[model samples]
Each structure stands twice: as C-alpha cells, then as structure tokens.
Target: MESSVFFENSEKKKKAIGIIHRVYLSQLKNSRKYLASTKTKSEIRGGGRKPWKQKGTGRARAGSIRSPLFVGGGVIFGPKPRLVYKKINKKERKLATISALFLKEKQLVLVNENEFLNFDQIETKLICQLLSKFELEEQKKILFILPKPNKKFWLSSRNLKNVEVTTVTCLNLKQLLKASHIILSKESFDLIKLTYGQQ
Candidate 1:
C-alpha cells in the first residue's frame, strides 16, 4: 500500500525510531511466558534423611542430599516463575505501529479482497502461486492482514512457515516489525488507515 500522508512529516519520521524501539521492547517483554521454575531445598523431595552421621563418617559432615552443592540437589538461586510487564501509552503504541508501517511501506502489497475469495478447495499451492505473483516467494516472513478472518485463506496459508495471517484488530507491534513483507487486503488497509491514521 502507499505510504500514508500522516507519516510524511520529516519530524515525525525522525522521532518514530525511538518510539518504535520502545514499543517493540515493551511488546517483547509483555509476551514472555516466564514459566521457568526450579525447586528450592525445602521444596525438593527425598531430602528428609541425613546423608550420613555428622561426625563419624570419613567424608565431611553430611546434610540432606538435596543440598545445593550435591549432584542432584536443589538450586540455590535458580529462576522462578514470575511476570515481567512493560506498559506503553496508547498513543505511543499507535504511533509506533504507524511508524513501522511507514518503514515497511516499500515492502507492502495491496490486493483486492476478491482475489482471496472463492477458493474451490483448500490448497497450499494456491497460496504459493499468490506469493509468486507478488514476487514474494523467497521472502522469509510475510504478514497478511485481513479485514476479518477467512477460514479458507487462513487454512491455505497455515502450512507455510514464513507466512502469518492476522486481522487488523489482532495486529501488534512485534508482528509489524518482524515481517519482511506485509500483504493487506483493500478492506484491511482501509481499516488500518481509519484506526491509526487519523491521529
């Protein structure tokens, strides 16, 4: 799609770099699952019995087998499940998304929505042919923005490792930044302009 007039201001372009970086980092941080967990000494099982007598054993005074120093022991300061969140202002996020779109304008392709409709049968080759027509067959990552979900289109594109399909409402900063090429249906492009361009 053509670059939006909203992004034409040189001053805005200059400031977009910092905003985009901040939003990208915020989205990345917020997406983390943070599910790593390690057992502490008290939490470890089978540590109830002392390894040996404290003084009589030839080896050094013994404690529970689950001591951190032991072979199969509890971790001292291992990672625990926790949340990491970074919040960005609504306006800032919108600006960052717009900036990302502006940066990727050259890689953007606008297609009529009808071209993706009336699939007689689901086929991966059809999607491949569509990409070939756009000269994006070799592109590593392509993002498809649809006005709404299309099961046939989604199914046809799912097998491709490098293609992603998302609606305008579900679009996010990370996806926008990571995509090497973005394909937008005419309706989807208009929706994005309506949502992110007025400001």
Candidate 2:
C-alpha cells in the first residue's frame, strides 16, 4: 500500500483528531479500575448499638458510632466501586487506531521478520542491540508489533522497562498512543495495511 493513503488531508485530519481523542478517552475509561470504595454508615462494623441515648446529658444526640460526624465513622456520599466503561463502536475504534498510526508515522519503523528470528536465545542484549541498530535506544517508550506471538522475542524484551512487545491481533489505541516509537515487523505492517487500509 502507498504511504500516501495514511496521510489525511486537512478536513480529514480534523475529523481524525476528534476520533483519536474520543477513542483514547474511551480506552482509558474502560481499563480504569473503580476500586476507591468507602463504607457507608449501615455497613460499618460495631454500629449496631446506639453510642448514647438520643437525649444525652451534655453531649450532642448520637445514634451509632458509625455516624458520619465521628472521626472513624462511615463516609457520606463517598465513592463506591462502580462501572465507568465507555463503549466504542468497532468502526470508530478502527478509525482512531488508524488515525493514531498516521499521526505517529514518523516514529514507525519497519523491520524484516528474519531480523527478529535471527535471535538464537532469550537475551535482553539482543533486543538492546536491535534498538541501538534502529537508533531507538533513547526512546522512552517503544512498542513492538509482531504478526504472531514469539515467546523468545517477548521474553528477551520483557526486562526492558521502556520496551513492550505485542502481537498485531492485540493492538489497541492505548498502546499506539502511549508508544514513543513503534517497531513493526514487515508481515505485521502488511497485516495492518490489509485490515485497516480499506477504511
């Protein structure tokens, strides 16, 4: 496929920008864990009995020790675990992924499959050498897209905090947008072209 196909014109670029933003936000929302939960008065322990009589001597009227007014009491209107997923349509996601790729085209690097297959053992040094060869050693976040899963390659690159390896099938907008540089195998590049080029 021609590289020109990935280059969007002015009007299309505007639309792509919106799509990319929406998709990126949606990805973040869906992956977020709503674990910030607080206990309510009823759910608090040791709250079964009233702390004091409703008509107390000099203290304020107290019901349960779990009242929100207490220091160790349950929270009021506090956060609870709930879903915050934003559903993104398949076509919209595809367009956003394509748009991200287009925007980051300068950071994309293509390599032959043989280059990775040449690694005989699981060694971080090999991956480091490869990055040095591509002049991506200084990049903060590098993503490797492979046509298929390779245990050896994945293992070799796993130790690098800045490098991540993933198969094309698992590619998503979050990964693409987070990467400072994306290394694609020739076959993986072709696969992406075939899958997203038509759109």
TM-score of each: 0.80, 0.86
* Count of clashing pairs, candidate 2: 0
lDDT of 2 by residue, 1-199 (tens): 3436655567777888899999888888899999899999889888778887778378898888889999889999999999887889988988888778878888899898888778678999999999999888645899999888889999998899989998877888888988999998778987886777546
Best by lDDT: 2
Each candidate structure's count of clashing pairs? 0, 0
- lDDT: worst 10-residue window of model 1: 1-10
Question: Runs in model 2 with CA error above 4 Å?
Answer: 1-3, 51-62
Candidate 1 lDDT tens digits, 1-199? 4354656777877789889998888888898899999999889888899988888667987679989889888999999999988878988988888778878888789888876675557898988988898888645899988888788889998899999989887788888888999998778878887888655
Q: Give the TM-score of candidate 2.
A: 0.86
Q: What would you estimate as the lDDT of candidate 2?
A: 0.84
